[model samples]
Structure formats: C-alpha cells, structure tokens
Target chain A: MILVMGPVDELVTAFFLKHLTDTKREYLFVDERHLGGDVRLELDLPQGPSGKGRLRGAVHFPTWRVGLEELTGIYSRLGTGNVEQRKTPEARAEQAHAAALLDLFPGPVANRATAMLSNGSKPCQYAAILAAGLRVPDTLVGGTWERWEPFARALDGDPVIKSVSDERSLVKQVSWEATRASARPGQALAPHQFQQRIHGTNIRAHVVGARHVLACRAETQALDYRHPDMTGHTVSLRATELPEPVAEACRRLSRALGVDLAGIDLIEPPGGSSRPEDWVCLEVNTCPGFMWFEQNAGLPIARVLADFLGTPLGS
Target chain B: MSNQSTDAGLISSQDLPKLAEAGHVAAPTVGNSAAELREAVQAALAEQWSLMGIIDTGKKASDLGKKAADALTDKGKEIEDKAIHREKDARDEAHRKMNDDKAKKHGREAGAHGATTNAFARALSELRG
Candidate 1:
C-alpha cells in the first residue's frame, strides 16, 4: 500500500491518484483538507533496549478507517500548513502532531522533511550541488549597495539580481547605468543575491527515481523564459538528451540532496557542448510544477512517479 | 512479541541506503583517472630521459658547437624582448578601452539621474495640488 500525502486536488497528486486507481493499487490520499471525522493517532516508542517500536493509527472517516501501518511507500507533497479552515491554537497543534507522525513512517519517502530543509536557503543548496561535483555560478550575497556596486562592476557581462530566499522574485538583469540612476539611499537594507549571468538555453530535467525526462527551451530575449514577450520570438520546448556526465551529475546531486525526485535546472551553453564542466546547474526544485512541462513536451511524469511509488524499496 | 517482518512500520537507515543504491544512483568519478594516468606516464618518461643523460655525461661539446649554441641563445633573447614590447603595447590599448567604456557608462547614468529627478519633482508637485 502507498500513502499519497498532499492536497488531492493538486494536479500532480490527482494525476498520480488516477493511475493508482487504474492499477487497482491500495493507496490512501491523505490531505489536511480531509481531517477529523473521528481521526486519532496512536504511536508507541518503547523504552528498553529490547523493546520494539510500533505505530498503529487510523483516520476514521465516514466511510473508511485508513490504517497507517499498511503503507509500504509514501509520496509527500505536504506544504507548510494545516488543513483547518481557521488558524486556531488547537488546529495548529493537531497539524504539527500529524506532520511529525507521518515523518516517523520511514518507508521510501520521496523526500523527508529534514532533507527538504536545504531548499529553504539558496546558498546551502549551492554548496550541496558543488559537493556533488556539479558546477554553480559564482555568487555574491550582500545587503549594502556600497559592497554590491564594486562586485557588479567587476563582472564581465550583466549580473542577475534576485532574492536570496525561495520567495518569488523577478530575476532581472542588472544594467549598471540604469541601476545607478534608480539607486535610492538605504536601498540595499535587504539581502540580495548577485549571480554571474550565464548565457545559454534552459534545460529542465524531471528526475523521477532513476529516470531523467529532459526538455530544452529555446533561447529567449527575456531574462526569464516564464515571462516571454508574445510578439517576439516564441520559446519552444523539445525533448532532448542530457550529456552523460551531466546526467550523472544530476543523479548524484539528487542523491546528495536526499530527494528521490527532483526538477533540476541546467544551463546548456550554445554550440551544444556536452562537457560536464561547461554546464551550470541553476537549482533543484524539490516540488516542481510538472503540468507546464507535461503539457508542452507530452511527458508522462505522473505515470513515472506512480510506478516509482508502487515498486518495492529494493526492487 | 519480536516482529521481524520486513513490512514493519518505519524505514530504517539500513533500508534507506538499499533504496538509493537499488535505484542505480549515478556515482560520478571524483577525478579524471585517464588524465592522471597520462601525467604518470609523462613523469616516468622524463625520469628515464634524465637517467639516459647521466649515462652519457662523458660526451663533451666541440668549440664550434659551443659558438653555435651561444649565437642561438642571443637570437632567442632578441625575439623575447620584441615579444615583451608588443605585449606591453597591447595591455595599454586594452586599459585605454576599459577607461573609455567606464566614462561613457557614467555619462549615461548621470543623464538618467537628471531625468529621474525631474520626473520625481513633477509628480511631487502634482500630488501637492
């Protein structure tokens, strides 16, 4: 049996659940949205050395009492909050307890909460990627314009300025001339990331277990392809092969980050260079939105994820 | 009750490693072994050549051979001096271009600043009304 943890209405979750149903697999879709009909949790962590730990719990809904122990695999997409409509103290406590309990399940979880914490910091993620033998852009993180101005001037080409955190920030190319004019006193009070801009086409690889489903987007005039100009040259997505070393790097990086599934962003330089050292890994998205890539490239990412979950731990 | 079943509730550390390994996770090579091998071979050849020179140390250069060697050394020095002069000229040219680019950029920025200040003043006056 498999446990799918996340909002069931989410497209990725819904698609995977459909495949599981077609295969007649015994699975439970556990979301905070469907909590507390008669839901209760019981966990026993024995005290003595000889004592064995046991977790036996059930969520009693109107129609089913889903046993937690029967789960052999788990795919968790649980974001940061509880399913409760109102944010009460009791609801928060229950949500915390439920999240912790699920962490104890210990089967082949797609990603553990502890492992996913690295995504919270871009610097930490870059360090992990470097250690995994992947190349990362030279970065400068600073809070003051006095310090940032020199670094920006030293770069050969335009540098990319973005937020240091995972929060959505427009990745804009720094034009020293324009920025110098728009500069306001105390503007650099907040920390910002200054990365050496790389020139290349973007390649996003959805790595499901051991499989790498890669798609390449054509070069665009926009700094970020997500917000492309409609009248200008349109960006195109096509299935492509990753250089062997890059493919290996992606796999190693995913393992090092302790995420079984990941969406790895790689910058493939022009002239189609396959040398591993030439490619730059931008970032690894632990929970990437697959609907856009799936709709564009016609890749069966959901089916791949479902098959990976249904398979046994060592098989 | 000692429940030794593999289907027990939680995944153990031992179980997690097996899952990662079983997935055929790519283990990238830490260093270029082929390049290392080539370097090793080159060092060995260099040592052999040095040893061969030691064995032939008794060979002496003739007076004519010595004169030719000195002439070649003088020619090399002349070529080296010209190369150095050319390199210096190239460096100076590059430095000049960089300074020019910086000046042009600063001029553009100053112009933009003037425009921005004018726009801000206009907006402020409109808001006051």
Candidate 2:
C-alpha cells in the first residue's frame, strides 16, 4: 500500500488522495492536520546491519492500523513547523516520527530528507545541474558591497537578486541606486544571491521517478512567473514538449540530486538551437507544488504521481 | 525593465511579522468520535466535486455530494454547491499568492542584520557536505 502523508486540506495532498481514491489504489493517509489527536505513530529502530535493523513500526488512525511493512512507497508533503509548534509534544512527536520513517524507509520515497538538503544551497544544486550537462546562469552569492559593485557593473543587463538558499525571494533587479547605497561606510547588507538575468521562455519540467517527464511552458512577462501579480503581468501555462537531451538531463539531474520526483525550472533562450546546453537551469525543486501547473496546463500530474506511489518498489 | 522599485510581493514589509505568526497558527481539531470523524471526513471529500475534472469517475464527487445533500432533506445541494465554489475560489486565491507569501516571509527574516550572513554560512557548510 502507498502511504501519503500531509494535511488533507492542502491542495496537492488533497488532489493526490483524490486520485488514489478515484483509481481504487490501496493506500493510507496520515493526516497532518490532526496528527496530535487522530493519528499516532511509533517506530523502533536499532543500530547495526543485522536483519533486526530493518524498520519496524506502525501508524495508527482512529479505527485502522497500517504497518510499515505493508507500505511499498511513500509520498510526504510535511512542512517543518516553527519553534512554538515544535514545542507541542504530541504534534512534534508525530512529525518527527513521520520524518524518520520517510528518511529510513527502504522502499521508494518521493524524496528522502537527506536528498533534499541540496535545496538548502542553490550553488550546491548548481554543481549537480552542471554535472547533468545543463548550463546555469552566472551567479554570485554573498559578497561584500565593494566586491559586488564591479560584478554588477560588468553584467550585460541589470543583475537580479534572490535568496541564496531555498528561502523564497522574488527575482528582483537591484537598482543601481540600491547597489550604490550599500557602498556607504558601515552600512550593513544581507548576503544575497545576484545572478546575470537570462532572457528566455520559462519551462517547468516535472520529472517523476527515473523517466516520466511532464513539462509545461509559462507564458509571462513578469520577472518571476510565480508572483506575476507583483510585476503586474498575468501568466498562463500550457503543456510543452522538451527535446530528448534536455529531458534526459532533467532525469539525470533528478537522479543526481537523489530526488525520486523533481520540478526543474529551465530557461530556453530565444533563438537558440534546441539542445541541453542551450537551456539554463534555475534550480531543482525537491518538494514542488505541482497542482498549480496541473490545474492550469491540464497536465495529469496527480495521476502520474498516484501511479508512481502505488507501484511497488523494484517492480 | 522599469526603474521604479517595488516590494517583492503584494505583502508589504509591515505585514511580514504578522504573516509569519499567522502561518504558525494551528487549525482546530474536531472533538468527535472516531466514527463521526470518519463520516465527517468522507462527507468533506465531497468538496472535491467542484475541482477540475482531470479524470472521469462517472458522475464523480459532485454526484456523491448531491446524493448526500439529497439524503439530508434540506436545500442542502445548493448550499453544498455554494460552499464548494467558495472553497475553490479560496484555493485559487491561495495558489496565486502562495509563493509570494513565502518569498515575503523569507525576505523579511533574511533581511535582518546578521540572519543572511548566518544563513549563507550555514548554506556553504551544507554545500561542503
């Protein structure tokens, strides 16, 4: 049975569960919303590589019990809680227990927490992206004002700044005035990521498991399609095709990053030969919110995801 | 590109702290019995009816909602439809603003005096691993 873990009210998780139910797939859901009250989990993990070291546990719902051994795959969308929520004993326990199972499960997990660590550093992900034979835009992370001034001046266009890590920040072009203001003596500045803005069409490719690639093109004039409202530009999405090599690179990148599922953002440069090298990879999202793409582009992402999670590992 | 600067999103900097607080507020859990909660959850699944039909389940969740509402013997179908539409609207609104909300929250926190330095340092260490 597949184990889907997340809040039932959440769009992605809700749709996933709906897909599984509609398809009559055998599955169990650990609702995160009422974890402290309605759901309970227990795990007993021992050290060493002996047979007893295998994961042994069960998740208990109000009227049903699901053993770890019964699960063949797991798809977790659990978000980390803040300091105060972390202090809540029961909720904290369930979150930690669920997280541990996701981490230690021998079967297929959409993403193991360890694999998702690369998302913490965009530069770190860039190395893997490059290894997968994709180009990454020239990027500078966390430099002094005196150091960045020369780099920004040399850019062909205004440099856009974003959060260096997975921390969300809309792509914004730093005005020369803002750049110049940092030069004043004793003025404090946060270490932000500045990248040479690449002009191109936005393509989001969702790579599932090893080979399933569902891609869509975002038609937008906004600097960041995700928040087009911020730039007063509306956005639309449509299913698109990717060249084989680029799609393969996406698969390789997903494999390299150790994510069973990934949402890779790519910029297809205008007037370029359709080749993997011509595409600029922005970043690989480990836990992508794919429902938006599915809703807009009419892509069957949830169905594909359900099939992936329902299939037994190594089958 | 225009020279005029703008905030990262519709969320102003002043609202950042409040958003952070609101994000952490937990939803209240139901105090019903197991059977009642299960029945309620199954009924709540009816809300999926108004969603885009990605697959044809032969009349689907809406049919189920209508059946349940019919069993209630009130003007329940209309009320159910309205609730579903309201939920769908809320979800659409949430979907559009989700990224901006996260961006503004992170931007506010990371803009603090030394948070970026510490975060970057931690990132570098993670990269080294």
Candidate 3:
C-alpha cells in the first residue's frame, strides 16, 4: 500500500490521488488538516536484540487502519503549517511523534528526512551539485565591503544578490553602481549571497528516480524565472531535451543529494553550444511543484510517481 | 487485535494476522503503549524540529545582523558626510587665513615703500636748503 501525506486540498495531492485511483492501487492518505479526526497513529516499538527490532504500528484513518508493514512506499509532501504553529504540549508532541514515525518508515520514500537536509542550506546543495561534476556560478557569502568591492569590480556584469538560505528572497541584480552606493566602511554586517549572474534560459529538469527525466524550458528575462513575468502571468513552460552530458549530470546531482525525485535547475548559456560544460547548476529543489509541468509539458507526472511507488499505470 | 470492525474499509482484525502469515504483511513487534510510542516519536520529531529551528534562528540572526550592519553603514555615511563638511570648512578657513596674510603682507610692503619715498623727499629738501 502506498501512503500519501500532504494537504488533501493541494492540487498535487489531488493529482496523485486521481492517478492512484486510475491505477486502482491500495493506498492511504494522511491529510494535515485532520489530525485526530481523520487520522491517528498508534505505533509500538519493542526492545529486541540489535538489528532484530521491528517497528509495529497502524495509522487509523476514518475509513481505514493501515498496518505499518503493509506500506510499500510513501510520497510525503508534509508541510509544517498545521503542526509548526501549535503551542500546546500535546500538539507539539503529536507532531514530533508523527515526524519520527515518518522518519522511521521503511519503504521507498521519495526522500528520507536525512536526505532533505541539504535543501535547508543552498551552500550544501551547491556542494552536492559540484560533487556531481556540475558547474555552479561563482558565489560569495557574507563578506565585508573590503572583500565585496574588489569582487564587484572584477565582475564583468552585475552580480545577483540573494539569501544564503532557502527563504524566498528576490534575486536582485546588484549593479556595480548599486554595490558602490550601498558600500559602508566595515565588514558586511548580515549574511548575503552574491553570485556571478549567468545569462541564459532557465531549464528545470525533473528527475524521477534514476531512469525518468522530464525537462522543461522556460523563456523569461527575469533573474528568477520561477516568479511571474512582467504581465503577472507565469512564464511559459515547454517540454525540452538536454544534452546527454547535462542530463547525466542532473541524474548524478539527484543521487548526490540523496533524493530519488528532484527538480534540478540549470542555466543554458546563450551560445548555440549545448555542451555540458556550458550549463551552470543553480540548485536542487527537494519538493518540486509539478502542476505547471503537468499543465504545460503535458507529462504524466502523477502517473510516473505512481509507477515509482510500485503501481504501474493502468494497473 | 480484536476481530471487530471499527471502520468499513479497514481490514478485519482476523485477516490481519492471516495476511501476516501469508507474508503480505510483517508481524508487528509489540511492547510499548500507544502513548509511549507517541512520546518516542515526539522526541525524535523534536530533535528534527530543533535542528530546523536552529537553521531558521540562524537565518533570523543573520538577517538581524544585516539590518544592524545596514544601520551602522547609515551611521557611517552620516559621519562621512560630517567629515566631508568639516574638511570643506577647514579648507575654507585655511584659504581665508592665507588670503588675509597675503593682504597684510602687501599692506606692509606699501607702507615701507611710502616711508622710503617720504624720507628721500625730506633729504632732497634738506639738500636744497
């Protein structure tokens, strides 16, 4: 049985459920909106010899009680909105317990909690990307004016300033003039990430497991193409192909990041050359939203996910 | 496990162990109470959440540090402006002092020349006498 965890109202979740229904797969969904009412977890862990212990539990939903051992795979997009804001001790404890159980789930989880840690820090993600033999833009993190001034002066064009962490901060281009204007006579006070901006089309490659890759090309001039275009409409997405080496690099990046499923962002330089070396690795997104890719690329992402979970399409 | 059906879609209690026997499901290891299990899970989650919190706190601290640095930069700019003004005032004062000294020096030279002329005229008169 496959276990899906997330907000039921989420479009992604709905899509997955619809695909699962089409495949007639036995599955359970743990909705965040209903903790005690719609779902409750009763887990028991017994003391046993080392390496011999097994976790036993059942997640009771209003309609089903799913045995822990029956779970073949888990697709978790659990957000912290419902649990993170609770101040009560009971709620906190329940959430923590749920998280622990999730961590302990022994199945083909799309991503284990430990593997997801890299996304918390872009630097960590970049290191993984670099380890995968992908090129990352030159980056400077948290330096004083003394350091930034020379770096700014050396850059051929404006550098992109962004948050070092994963918080959604605007990718603002730092013109040489802006940097000079903002310069003060001391070390840089707060943490900022500056990268040599690469001019190219934004390519997002969704790597599913090791075998499946869906590449999408987006045309936009924004520093971050994830945001809407100037007309308040989303940037157009179309199915595209990557150079063989670049595709292999993306696969390697996915494995290095310990994610079976990931959205790997790359920049294809303006030149006609499709060489792997010409592309720059931006970052790996752990929980990528596939709504746009599904809508625009016409790729059956949900069906693919079902297949990854051991349920073939039209099973 | 009881054989009673608590919910419709759930597997009957009797069928659970049978499924386990069939190797469709593994037998559950039993010991801790549900509450204890919840507590354990919560403890584990707490650790994970704390780690996440640490990262978040670090980000916040970084942002605050940036804000403070920006404030310091603003203050520095203010001081820089004041210093520029002070430098300009000092330069103007020096220029005024130099100009005043030059004017005084010219005046002294003129006075000395006038005295010399007067003395010469007086000597001429005496000679004529």
Candidate 4:
C-alpha cells in the first residue's frame, strides 16, 4: 500500500496516482492532527480573570483530514517550517516523530525519514556526496568576512554568495557576487553562504529505479543558475548515457543515502566535455521538479513510471 | 512493507492484483508513439510560453513605470545641458548678423551724408555694447 503524508501537490499527485497498479495498495495521507484518524487538538491559551487564568476554547488543525494505517510505504515532503509548524509544538513533534518511525516500515519508504532529515542539511549532503566518491565543487562556508581579500585574490574575482538552508535558496542566488568595493565582509554577512564559483555546464540527473535520466541546463545568465528571467536562452533535453562506473556510483549513492529516487545536479567544464569522468557532481535533490522534465523531454517520464510500476520483480 | 512500483497504473482498476499474482507486469503502451509525444511536448511548450508571456508582461510594465519615473526626475539636468549650448550659439549668430546689417546700412547712410557714417555707426556700436 502507498501512504503519502504531508504536502503533496495536486500536479504531482495526478501523475503519481496514474502509476498505482495494485488494487490492494491503498494510498493514504496524514499530517499532525490527522494521522489516518480524526483527532482534534485545541490550544490551551488561558484568559486571565480575577487574577487567575481560565482555559480558552481550543482550535484544531485547519482543513484536517486523514485515513492512515492501511498503507505500506509513506512518501513525505513535509518540512519543519512549512506545514508542520501550523500544528501545536506537541503535535508537530508528534507527527515528525511518527514519520521518523516509518523508517522501520517493512516496505520501502520513498525516503527514510531520518535519513532525509539528516541529509536534508546542505553540509550533510555535501559531505555525503563527497564521501560517495562523487565530485562536488569546492565549497567553503564561514562567517568570517575578514577572509574576503585573500579569497578574492585566490578566486581572481567576486565570490558567489548564497544561502545554505532551505529558507535561503542558492538556486536564485548563484548568479550574484560580492564585489570587493561593496562587500562589508564579516560585518554585513552573518547567515549567508559565500563560495568560490564553479564555471561549467549545469546537469540535473534524475534517477528512478535503475534508470538515470539526465537533464543538462547551461544557464549563461547573471545572478543565479535557475534564472527567473530565463527568456531567449535555449536548453535542450535528451537522455544521457552515463558510463557504467558512474551509473553504479549513482545507484550506490542512492542506496547509501537510503532514498529510492534522487535528482543529482552536476557540472562539467566546457573543456571537460570529452570525458564522462570530468563531470563534477554538484548536489542531490531528494524531490525534483519531475513535471519540468516530463514537459521538456519526450522521455514519457510518466509512462516510464507506469512501466516501472506495471511489472514486479523479474517480470 | 510499503507500496511497490508494481502497484501503480492498472488503467482499469479491475483485476489489479492479478498483475502481482502473475509476477510478470506488463509495460504500459502509453509511451510508444514518438510523434504523439512530440506533439504533446510542443503543446506543453506553447502553454508554458503563454504563461511566461503573462508573467513577463507584468514585469516589463513594472520596469517601464520605474524608468519613466527616473526619466522624469532626471530630465531637468539634460535640458540644462542643451540650453547652455543653445545660448552660446544664439549669441554668436546675433553678433554676425549685426555686423552684416551695419555694413549694408552704413554704405547708404554715408552716401546721403556726403561722408562715411562710420562715426555714427561707431556711436551706435558703443550704445549697443
């Protein structure tokens, strides 16, 4: 059975739902207050009356509904800040702890919750990818602005600054740099990521089962890799055959990370195009923009999904 | 255990578990036609382009409005530069025309006076100065 909990958008749900083949495989979803069953939780804020506090009426999770338990795998995309915070602290912790408990689930959880949470951190992911023997750009994260002069001298130009965590996305921040003249260095930069830029082509490799579908994007734009004003720039999508060694590396990486699927972003210098080994792994996306690839590439990503689901082991 | 990949896409929900029982799952015929897929891609691209256009139009309008305000604010400085050069050109042209008129009027006036009106002209030049 398929149990999808937390925030799954309708756009993705449609394609995902189209792939379910087994009738007994029931897909169930739940959040904090609605964990496969109805449970109303109200706030215990008190109103002071006659120098004493009185309990106020409680409030439940808004638009809450769930039918959990009768499912096998659980696919989660919830975050600490987004939907979970809407519930009370106790409830949020409860749901998170519950999701974490699913790693012990008999069937494959799309992502082992504990693994995802730990790998979800940028530093953790960077370290894991590096440890996996996949190449990643040399990144340095520090709060010291005093090192800028030397860093710039080493870089020969402005340092690319970005955010490491989810709330501060580097996708849009990749294009901008901290100029020597404008940089207030340490005083201005408290919680930000400044790394030496990697000059190369951007590649997004989506892995499903044993198949690896590669999407390469050369964002020759200013400020970010995914340019918001991405017009006039052309990007082509085609299936890239990764060498056996790299394919195994990706599989091993996925296995090691305990994720069923991952979208690994890589970069290769234009000069390094002659060899496959030259492709440097950038970062792995646990949840990728599958719709974008399905629209751009005629790979029948959805059908591939259906095909993958249509058959059982050795079938 | 969680749902397996074999659990998705029955097309018709009837006899769904028969797929698992058979142990051999049939690959869906949904992806075969390359041309059909190509058409779908084109249509999807067109729709995305339309959506992008709407978003771009809004952004462009906002940018244009900002530029219009900046031009309005900074137009005074540009006008001053043009006016300064214009004043110099007008002054030079006025002096040249004055000399030419003096030559023409002075010749006729001198003939009437049986003497050059250069003296009177000089007097007029001093007064003009």
- Chain B TM-score of model 4, please? 0.31
Q: Quick one: best TM-score, which candidate?
A: 2
Task: Quote the TM-score that chain A achieves in each candidate.
Answer: 0.85, 0.91, 0.86, 0.69
Q: What's the DockQ for every one of the candidates?
A: 0.01, 0.05, 0.01, 0.01
Model 1, A131-162: lDDT tens digits are: 76777888888657776778788888878987
lDDT of 4 by residue, A7-71 (tens): 22222333344333222233433333243233332323233332211222221223432222233
Cα lDDT tens digits, model 2, A113-149, are 6676677779989988999999999888877777777
TM-score of each: 0.63, 0.72, 0.64, 0.54
In model 4, the runs with Cα more than 4 Å from the true position are: A8-15, A18-26, A31-33, A36-72, A80-90, A118-120, A168-188, A209-223, A228-236, A271-277, A299-315, B1-129
**Alpha carbon deviation, residue A180, candidate 1 (Å):** 3.4
- What TM-score does model 1 achieve against the real structure? 0.63
User: How would you encode candidate 4's per-residue C-alpha lDDT over B5-121 as one tens digit per residue?
Assistant: 112211111111111111011111112232332233233323433433444455456547656655776675466445435543553344344334433423343334442133643
Pairwise TM-score winner, candidates 3 and 4? 3
Q: Which stretches of candidate 1 lie over 4 Å from their true place?
A: A22-24, A36-42, A47-63, A80-85, A186-189, A210-219, A229-233, B1-129
Error of 3 at B55 (Å): 35
Clashes of 2: 0
**Clashing pairs for predicted structure model 1, backbone only:** A106-B11
